[model samples]
Target: MQQLNVIGLDQQGAEKLGKKLNKLLASYQIFYMNVRGFHWNIRGERFFELHVKFEETYNDLLLKIDEIAERILTLGQQPQHTYSNYLDNSSVEEAANIHDGRECVESILNSYQSVIRLQREILSAAAEIEDEGTASLMGDYITEQEKTAWMLTSYLK
Candidate 1:
């Protein structure tokens, strides 16, 4: 008989899912830090508004990071927790010293695009293995990120 994970997902598939989720976790860590930078350094005419928004964004990213890590654990794999590992594995690059509100918002939008794409890929993989837990998580992230992207784009316009 084939082995299955805690959630009844095929063992091999669950392992793959856990790896992908770890990559996602890495990306979220970098992105979360970047958003925190944006919140702290954002200036110019939109400082008051953008600062608050950036804080909200970083807080949300923090929550998602925790969720992704827990999901990896649920899938029977260890989540990568070191900054070195995150920097090495994540596609999202770290942003430094960004002060302009528009530039920071633009960077956030770009990062969200990358994350949303990855989540969609995860959704597909999870669906293939009938891992409803992962599929649901990815689906929720994609939906919320898409709407946030739309709002950020409008803010930029």
Candidate 2:
């Protein structure tokens, strides 16, 4: 007999979803750290504004990281927790020592694009297996991030 997860999802399908979520979690972790650096190191005349914004962004990313990790656990799989694991699995690259506000916003926009694309792919996979929980989460992230991207782009202009 085929095993199922606590939520009644097929074990195989849930396992695949868990792997994908772990990758997303890793990317979020890298992106979170990058934004934290941005928050700490950002300079320029816009320092006050960008500093607050970056703090808000990283805080939000931290929440999402926890949620993704919890979801992976709910799916009966372990999340990638270490920085090394995050580096290995994440598509987002680490940003270091960036102080310029424009540069930080640009880097953040790029990370948003990467994550949104990945979430869309995950959304498709979740939909294929009728995993509405994960699908809804991806959809929400995509929508929120798209709005954030637009705002950041305007900030650059």
Candidate 3:
């Protein structure tokens, strides 16, 4: 069998980073599901425009979900994929039963902020444990979610 290629992570540090990574992954999954809901249910005076915009936004969030899931696996953890896991693990709420355009916007903006906060915590954990790779990953997530939340919040105003 090949020896492990991952470098410099002691057991405790790696485990800490893995836990942070799984939380981030779960948050990404929740954000992605919420975006998909808005993409399908967005109907208003800007029906066509918002529908198209939601599609693009949801697609972007979907890609981030994939990246975060794979990052968790790279850290040697299984990704949380089931609805049960999501409902239990996610602080973000489901976007169904929402009828108002501004409501969807508000919910999504909240999700964006939540993910960004998670990213910051992850980055801090990784740095505290001296895991450069996971820290870098969390930094990228922070930037992504911050920019997304800024855009969505602006639209919501």
RMSD of each: 0.8, 0.9, 3.2
Tell me how many clashing residue pairs each candidate has.
0, 0, 0
Best TM-score among the predictions, by candidate number: 1
Local accuracy of candidate 2 as per-residue lDDT tens digits, 7-74: 98889998999999999999999999999999988888999988998999999999999999998898
Q: What C-alpha lDDT values do all the predictions have?
A: 0.93, 0.93, 0.74
Error of 2 at 53 (Å): 0.3
Question: Measured by TM-score, how close is model 3 to the native structure?
Answer: 0.88
Candidate 1, pairs of clashing residues: none
Estimate the lDDT of model 2: 0.93
Q: Estimate each model's TM-score.
A: 0.98, 0.97, 0.88
Model 3, residue 95: distance off in Å is 1.9
For candidate 1, give the lDDT of residue 139: 94
Off by over 4 Å in 1: none
Per-residue lDDT of 52 in model 2 = 94
